[model samples]
Target: MSATAISTDVYTQVQQFYARQMHALDACRFDEYAATFTEDGEFSHTPGRPAAHTRDGIARELRAFHEERFATEPVQRRHWFNMIHLIEAPDGSLRSTFYVLVVTSRPGERQPEIAPSCVVHDVLIRADGGLLNRSRRVEHDYLLDLKRT
Candidate 1:
């Protein structure tokens, strides 16, 4: 009803969107993962990796990489998002930034290892009755640290 309440509700919806998206990715559900993005969504990483454009591009690229990783060694990747901050633009789109910790494990590892963490900035919008990511850029912590030294 109030402005703050509406903002909180929007943030909550985006949070829920992230929950579903991450779970789908963790489980290697390619279709589900792709659905989290817009049809023309683009995902890119800062420092090195090339961007993947479009929903199919995002899904295919990740699927190939993950499938190969599974084939070489059954590695399970779990993504944890934290410290999410959201800002709504006047045009009704949302900009969000969050920290991600990727935990990975394989057959004989004593414990899961924490892979290099990153800060992800995403442009999200409400579409097709739900929130979808329009663009995402990941800034790797190690890469940034390396630049300092």
Candidate 2:
């Protein structure tokens, strides 16, 4: 195959990996979400929010927060990714930016509340089997509406 084709394939793989990651999160599959990262991967909502600098760190933080905050609540989250832009790095890795819209709803809610759509900047490292997310930075576009049910 040609070089361009190979690069396209790699990009597509990375995109699909990201899609699956979002799916896992939407499904509340936290373990799977944790598995999407590398051992020392980093996932951060923003600069001020707590950052998960490793797979174990992410799992710990997420599990603890979920247990404490939503122990008795039932909610669903859905993420939509769009405007994906990818570029091949010098070492054949991939760098990508995309826009994401997340909506959260409770079981009896009349309407799902949409979180501020954000731009995600990410670095994907190509590994032996596939691509792994080395880092992810999320930039929220608006202030969070914190009025709780």
Best by TM-score: 1
In candidate 1, how many clashes are counted? 0
What is the Cα-based lDDT of residue 65 in candidate 1? 70
For model 1 the TM-score comes to 0.87
Clashing pairs in 1: none
- Using lDDT, give the best candidate's number: 1
Show model 2 residue runs off by greater than 4 Å.
1-7, 143-149
Provide the global lDDT of candidate 2 against the true structure: 0.78
Q: How many backbone clashes are present in model 2? A: 0
What TM-score fits each model? 0.87, 0.81
